[model samples]
Target: MGSNDSEYFSDEEEAWVMYKDRSEWADITPLPQNDGPNPVVRIAYSDTFTDVYDYFRAVVAKGELSERALQLTEDALHMNTANYTVWQYRRKCLAHLGSDLEKELVFCREMIELNPKNYQVWHHRRVIVEWNGHADKELRLTEIIFSQDAKNYHAWEHRQWVLRTYRLYDGELEYVNRLLEEDVRNNSAWNQRYFVIVQTTGYTQDVIKQEVEYTKKAIEKVVNNESPWSYLRGVLQHSEKGLHSVEGLESWCMALHEAGNNSPFLMAFLIDLAEDTMECHIEEREEKLAKVLEWCESLATEHDKIRREFWRYMARHISHKYSV
Candidate 1:
């Protein structure tokens, strides 16, 4: 059987076939669902790299854009999905060939499974969704991709575009909450939460007030994690209140600092709060701001040596703490 198999596969496509229990979707298309040593591509074709490459060149040479041109491009992409030119040409062919875009979405999703970070595949997938106008399906597919890699910029960008284009911001905050519950250190999740909040509610004080309570819970969860602290600063910075204007904010930082956290971010946040509360040239609250900044400088310099330069830079640049 092995010797006879050589007759069907091209030199580049030669591989062993191991039968396994296939899914109901197996007939849908040939994209491998499992990975193993020497995993062969599921797209069984006798087309060789040389043959596909030659045909692609011939089509481009003739400027012939048709459905027949897709076969050679697909074969080439099967070997190297990163080829931008091939993907661009394929898009042109796809549009002119009257090809089935629904099937193309399936193919693109399968390719994404092989390498989620492949730019061309994602670009092509985005183009198809935009052209076909399946906002709901695009949202669902992007959510699945985000579940696989929460911090994937491309996936997040696509999700944002889908939500904005379709006005689908209803459940995004809840989705972000789920992500945060899974890992509080997920900065991307925190960022997404902020995005959703802004998209739905804008920067109104009520929204900021609600977000502040939510953010404080996260900040106090792990005083050392910088992501939530950054999120807290970002949302609050856009609010009507200054950073330090939040009730008991200073004492909370003091409590966290005294909890033996040695967290540069908490200290840094407190330092910003103190500086923001001061008038630049009025000298009011200068004593309080100076003391807070000096304390943060000393703490960061001693315990967080990694960011000591940053603390030093803050001290050198900030004049709010100094008396006028």
Candidate 2:
């Protein structure tokens, strides 16, 4: 060895290494830390800026010790690298931003590796990507994360953030169309698409009209299934207009009929939709309510408990709203 190395160990650090050694899944990934400087240094609860700076200066001379400094600061600030103080300290300590940026990116990437569902870290990583390179860096990281786990909610959220922040929608909905093709059930992507369309340059009336028709056709294509209903409900939940046209409600009722009257999803949708959409003036509200009540009555003989609860809840709502 060109440079001499000194062995150091803290009791807390040793305990963690021992725990990692005993776990079966320990081989899957390298441990975050080992028997080095304690990752959790004994900093005072009310430490000042001088205290933090002095601590960094003291340990930064040793390469191994300085590496631990990043870990300790990351922990202290709870992974918020954007904090002005942490960013400044990191720049001061690392001296080379290219290496430092990579290290910071690695910390976030490691967290993404460990828990792909953490959108916050993914977002923070995007900020670093912005600082280091072009806007495309964020999308590249998002694509990498999504490739690793397609169903990762955090990754989807990160993608949406990148697109929205960049104002990256095409006029013909090309971006959304491609995204939905990736995963039709990607509600996060769908919601992002909706946001883009709503915010895009267009007359408000034209946008709303087009959105309504687009949504209607989209839901109509899948209304015979439960996922469609769930998707439709999500869309309707965000729209100011109601999805209570006799045609649409009747389509849902037909789905309930095809499902043979025992689908908890349909019943739950009916109950929640009725309550939530009461503010949306529908010419067919009473008719839709009658259809749902008829379905509940059809189930009364076989499912006494469900029927009783369903009818009681509906009756209470009706009483509160209609006064008889």
Candidate 3:
């Protein structure tokens, strides 16, 4: 087969037949081709993928752009939902045949439910949504998917893309708050919270202070959890110059340290906050800075054994930065 493959918007197909109870043999039927500028299929593959590939390979090569091609693409997509070629060809048909954008969205929604993890399925939906221009349902879809599986990276990524693309930030923070209420350890939820803050206010002093109070309570609820600690640092970064000082973070860290929680991230962030204080010309208490630096050395050499090298590097960087 030649390789005049789907090049534009190209990326990275299957079908099935049962033979005997033993080894399965694949169907190798050749697909129909239209007499047009291109009249041949040019994809190469084997096994369960050949039938759908063969058909779509020809449908696309022949530059078919009618309702027939659209129907065939729908069939081919059922066999291999992630085939970008089928998706691209389908888009062309949608345009050339004047297909309804809402109907296309419904088709893509079905595909997404059937193949949630398939990047092509989600990507195709994004293309359709970009055209359809009503992302309210898309946002709800992401939220629904995340509610069922909070850690689904694909769903979370799509959610982030949808919100950013549509500027649908209203209620986004509250949604994450509800999610965190269910599970504060959900780092994705925390990241979403941070994403919303940065988009809304660049984490102004008031916003940062509010988030600090929020996360302080969150971290207090779970001593060794890292989500609150990480989000606190992220929000602090956007606070006004010298305005992001670790207000209650030190007292919390001291309590955690005294309780032998000894969380590596807590200790690491504690030292980082100490450095941030020095940089901001806040009254740098040498004792406070020295205490966290010593904790960093201890964590690097003893406690945080898994990330020993990372903490060691942090220690060196801090020493060099402050001549400690």
Number of the top TM-score candidate: 1
Residue range with the least summed lDDT across 10 consecutive positions in model 2: 1-10
lDDT of 2: 0.52
Listed in order, each prediction's TM-score against the native is 0.80, 0.53, 0.78
Cα error of candidate 2 at position 169, Å = 3.0
Which is superior by TM-score, 1 or 3? 1
- Candidate 1 overall Cα lDDT vs. reference? 0.72
Q: Candidate 3 residues 1-324, lDDT tens each?
A: 222223211333112232211132122234544357775865454333454455556656667687856876776677667668778888889988878998888788777766678898888888888887779788888877776688888888888899898898988888988999999899999988888877777776778778888988898888678888878777777755442464666776778778887777777777766776776654665655576568877997787888878877876776666653
**TM-score ranking from best candidate downward:** 1, 3, 2
User: Candidates' lDDT values, in order?
Assistant: 0.72, 0.52, 0.72
Superposition error at 230 for model 3 (Å): 1.4
Q: Which digits, one per residue and each the tens of the lDDT, describe model 2 over residues 1-324? A: 101001112233334332224353232232221336765564322222323333433444333224455544554344233345554555444544245576677676765665566455566667776666545555666667666765577776776666667765544267556756666666655666656655665424455445546654555444433544564555454444445532366455556547656554456566555644444546646765664566455445444455677666665566467332
lDDT of 3 at 20: 17
